[model samples]
Target chain A: MAVLTDADIEALGLTLRLATTVTVLLLLLGLPLAWWLAHTRSRWRRPITAVVALPLVLPPTVLGFYLLMLLGPDGAVGRAMAALGLAALPFTFKGLVVASMLYSLPFVVQPLQNAFEAVGNRPLEVAACLRAGPLDRFFSIALPLALPGVLTAAVLGFAHTVGEFGVVLMIGGNIPGQTRVLSMRIYDHVQAGEYHQANVLSLCLLVVSFAALLAMSLLRTRRHSRD
Target chain B: MTDSPHGLEAKLAWRSGALAFDIDLSLPAQGITALFGPSGAGKTSCLRAIAGLEQHASGRVSFGSDVWQDSSHRVFLPPHRRRIGYVFQEPSLFTHRSVVGNLDFGYRRAGRPVHLDRDGLIDRFGLRPLLERRIDNLSGGERQRVSMVQALLSDPALLLFDEPLSALDGAARSDLMGCLESLHATLKVPMVYVSHNVDEVARLADHLVLMEAGHVVAQGNLQETLTRLDLPPALGEAVGTVIDGQVVDYDAHDQLIALEFVGGRLWLPYRHESVGQRLRCRIGARDVVLTKAPQEGTSALNQLPCRIVAVADADHPSQVLVQLDAGGSTLLARITRRSWHELALSPGSAVWAQVKAVALGL
Candidate 1:
């Protein structure tokens, strides 16, 4: 049986890096979108919410297939990147980042949206009356009050990105130390009939994901009791 | 602070689904103005409009010279821009922050000079030990006390209270009542208070705006409005008269204070109010006894010579409510059909009103 190799170590590092990048990007992009989804009374609220939540139900392979086409060399985004003197995004580290962000969008946004909704209107009204403007109220009141939800979102987003396989497989074609994350390395090991190496990588993913989900559930229960 | 000579003048109209409001009121610039009405009467909506919290409301609101809202001219100042402090029905203290942090949220945003600084309010509201405590541990009354202190610390030019004490039980309500009274005495900020309880309105409001079905049926000085014979019928049986008086003397031996009004002197249970301090004494119609002539044998503390101004139908068909003009002030007396018929009461008949009891309103 092969011991923990340098290739496995690099794959682990790359997975963590991609998950971190994707989680950070999702939080930045998802917070305002979640806030709008939570509070808006507009006609578009339901449709927009449905679109943001589509990833949860859509097959990851199908999503990956579409994303592959979108980032392919004659695609609109691909051509624009080429015009800007940049390589096409597919099969690159940056391409994996984009794919992971989409895969984890629902994981980050749903909890945050629920958290913002749970804050209710009364606190914001009180803050407004207390001379807190919109931004001031969000940072001082909404953000802090919704902290538990934010934590859940972060954990779920990071974990989901870390364990992601189909989207990464389709968009991030195996490339050592670039887009060959742990899941991809595990796939490589299993296809080569190296069952021991595959089992090791798979166990690491299972343990980490389980720990993260356990923490999330514990956080949720604590929050519910506090309420 | 700018003197709001016109007090608060709002001509606001709001429509949300089936409930709609059309209100035009001019409140006194100083002291508390209680918006008295039943639920769904649009009292809160009107108050929210004045505070710039009701989005659908359109019209003008001018506090003295400053125009807070004028939809016609598109001059609408948002809530944060307007120096108004509003306390909601619930005590919405920041759960994540310590008490001191919650207080500082308003204090830091207060661009105007601090009227009551943090330590000063903490001392005044007895919140020193609670400064570092988390808000979740506070009782309902304690949370409301902190809320009041927070609003006061901001030094609001105009304060809006929407049933701030409704969430508290009897003891907590009275405790916050005392705090509110003291805060009103200290700050003297123009306040628009919304309440369904008539007792609260009688005790705190200097100006009264009566609303029903989304309309201001009557608005005037609290003393005058309460006594007005033609008040909106929606006021129902809570109708009473507010007699403005002063504590001329306190009979220490009798445990009563001599409250002298324009009509006469009423001896009521002495509170801690000093002599010469003004008071608003609420005498309910049910509490006033009508007599043809002043009698000396009765144990009642007050009897005033009054002329029957009008005899109106009471909500209960069995009773007739007689309006009496005692000297310059007005008094309401709910007398039975037997007494009304036996005494032969008329619009201009001479009579003496015996007030058996008077509840001191603030």
Candidate 2:
């Protein structure tokens, strides 16, 4: 009996592509959102914070269900996309990425928010007096000081997306070479009584999750020691 | 100095936590203008408003021809847009950067023509050796030096210092003060220094603004304002005279130098300053004694024949403050009520004021 097959390799590759795409998109979206959440003195801060933090407490299935409602063909976003000459997101790799982003939103944003908040007003003010404009201050002073937090956010985002199972199962139905990520693949193996294939894939995921956390911790330690 | 084209005029009105600021100020074109007051007296607020650091500060503020802030016209330039450099109470150096990094942070951003000599300033401030060091590794004095060098590197049109030395120990404080006094002779840009320290103010300020409880009690030339009798009652103890003159005579054996001004001459212990260089000193009112005639047997070495200018009540009920004019320079003498009555002194009465050589603050 073969311990692994071509299908398992395809699932691993697909899982990586989905996690990479979602992590990149989350970072791009999360940077500014975290900055605003950290510094804005507006009255909407509490409500918006609560909304960003919703994924932390809400079950992954709950988020996936709501997203499925919103991004399905009859849903608001799905209708808008369809009108703009786009395919419906459900049961596709795109749907998995979209759902994973919502599921891992807090993991990405919270760290970045804490990082930017750690860069308090004094350094920015000092930079301004040195003839740096607002944007210049943000890039040169605020962002660099929050580098560790940024790294933690990126790692957590990538790992959380990789480990996510419920949202991917609900909105992104199992489909080989498309939405059959490692976690869902393991589920399919267990259901089929292919214990050997399941063990190999599950070990891969376990090692990957452990490595991601260890990498984040090691980077944090090196940075603190260097400082 | 009045003919110089640049000056600062500001009217700051704002309210921050637990403090309200309502101050109107006019500073001269050159030399140091000190905003002197106690903590929570709005001295720092006045400097911040002038530098465009306080966003909510309203009313008009103009530096030279540049209108820094005008609420009615909706003209307000932020700190970076205004050519002003600010030094806070504590060194606000970027911790993530090295000393050189902090120095370059402003130099690279400053718009040309910089017109400032970077290496000379670094050398003057003694920051050359610590260029590669991290900010966290620097001592308090060294950090302040870096702050000063960093500010000067930006080539700012105006510099504002907010109690830059209050955080340092005595040795560091005097060392930085030495740098500032040396820098003053060669510095071209106008500066605003805020401090509650009398010695720092007296040593550094050519002009003074006395603040008390969010109000400007008096503002004038350092010499004129310090000798003013009608300053706020809380500042009555600061009543003294500032003298600026040339070192005409130096007796090396006695370690004394004769400082001669338009009015007369007084001697102070020499501190290695060569003759013909100008120096300044402050004489406290309480250090002077009044007598009807000059006494030869007195141990006091500084005696001047001065005509009385004014007599006012001092802070204590038993003492009186007498203003005297030794020709053109003004002097203040604090005497008891009994001495005032026995001498029968009135404005215009001629008398001899005796000041101890050791009492002069050089």
Candidate 3:
């Protein structure tokens, strides 16, 4: 076992914060997109879905390269921020959050969209007939019914964000307190020949991810058993 | 009941693909108004249009004086604002919520000013035992009951049922129907009910709207509309007469209620009503037997004097419809061709219509 240290605790906390922040952001951005993707009959839906999924197939390094440019001082986002008198985003915790959100977009969207799709038009129509307006129906009927999908998506996004390396290295630049997430910390420990610390952190990640997956499965099983 | 809006009047027109529907109907707002038609004949579509769930091209839907939809003036109140309660074919309960929570959903959405009489609804629907149960744990009948209660909690101005009893088994369907019948009898809200089942329509509907291919083929009092022979055979086969009768006697030993119809006495199974109470009974054509004379030593309990008014094809190889006059009411008898020939049955033939005691739908 690796001896406990303040640095290790800080690294763990930072990783958790990054993962959580990224997951929340992804959920906020992905929910409406998922709803639209599931319900819309637009001709551009398939192509739009493919574009959203492009990052999943592309190399993580390639994604990180574009993100790096996007957040760089002279790049589009960075320049725009600078023009607004704000600091450029690269090499910061916020940059790491942005990179994690991008890399894990599909993790958030696919589950939510699948959940929305599974909810069909029947319930919504029934709700409408029962005198529920569109917004009311979405919150009261659609959101509650799609809860399992939301949990799965959030967990997957959070876990995937914690496991990211290439994107984090490109944009976050391994700052100890700010951007040294768990996966990057494990990579650093391995490179420095500290196998014990790397094993401990890796074990922690494994246990957490496995627990999340188990909880989701148990919830789904309980739902099916009731039905 | 308060003299608040007592009927539904609407002219709904909508087009989807090659299917275009234009319907004009006025239904008495008190009893069950059945939108009877075959599947895809726009029964559900009409219900949806009334509930404001369907956007019609040029339409006007009004309940009594409240205008729900008017496309000419571009006035359309969405479903929620229209205050119409709708129960779908499927229960469509929220699986994530417990039964109580699911029921509370609509109650809450009804806003702060209008509160549901939850205890009353729960008692009426027999939902107390299942109140805390999860929706997934309830049976088909139980789920439907909860859905109905949920809709009722919305305090709707009109209740629209889109084949609410179609998904249940025979026993459950009857149980649910009984509950609905009592609810309709007690509540002042008017209901527009949709069903493809003739038996269901016969049992529940006071008014009938017959639809064919997205058009209102006929609409009137249930007995009059159903007896029309011009409709498709499936509908025509189920065509019968509805008569309002009073329970004159209840023979406890025999488990029968001797009902006094317009013509004569008819015995039915004991129902949950007292003597002198009015009840509706549906007698299908197939259940009546026409005899040239009053027969004796038969188990049948009803033999009323009748004069044959018409004979129509029964759509079967060996059967025919014998329309007769029973006092002031019309009665139809479905008899085999062999029997017709044996009796030499024809229009204006005076015969006794013998009905078995059990065949009357009370």
Task: Using DockQ, give the best candidate's number.
Answer: 1
* Model 3 chain B weakest 10-residue run by lDDT: B1-10
Q: What is the Å distance of residue B38 in model 1 from its true position?
A: 1.6
Model 1: per-residue Cα lDDT over A175-214, one tens digit each: 9999999999999999999999999999999999999989
Least well predicted 10-residue stretch by lDDT in candidate 2 chain B: B1-10
After superposition, the stretches of candidate 3 with alpha carbons farther than 4 Å from their true spots are: A1-10, A192-197, A218-227, B1-6, B15-20, B55-58, B111-117, B252-255, B269-273, B296-299, B316-320, B335-349
The TM-score obtained for chain B by all candidates, in the order given, is 0.91, 0.96, 0.89
Tens digit of per-residue lDDT, candidate 1, span B324-345: 8888888888889889999988
Q: Judged by lDDT relative to the true structure, which candidate is superior, 1 or 2?
A: 2
- Ten-residue region with minimum lDDT total, candidate 3 chain A: A1-10
Q: Chain A TM-score, candidate 1? A: 0.95
Where in model 1 is the C-alpha error above 4 Å? Answer: A217-227, B1-4, B112-117, B249-254, B271-277, B296-299, B358-362
Instruction: List native contact recovery per candidate, as a fraction of 1.
Output: 0.82, 0.78, 0.76
Clashes, model 3: 1
Which of 1 and 3 is the better model by DockQ?
1
Per-residue lDDT for B129-167 in model 2, tens only?
999999888999999989888888787888899999999
Evaluate every candidate with DockQ and list the scores: 0.77, 0.72, 0.59
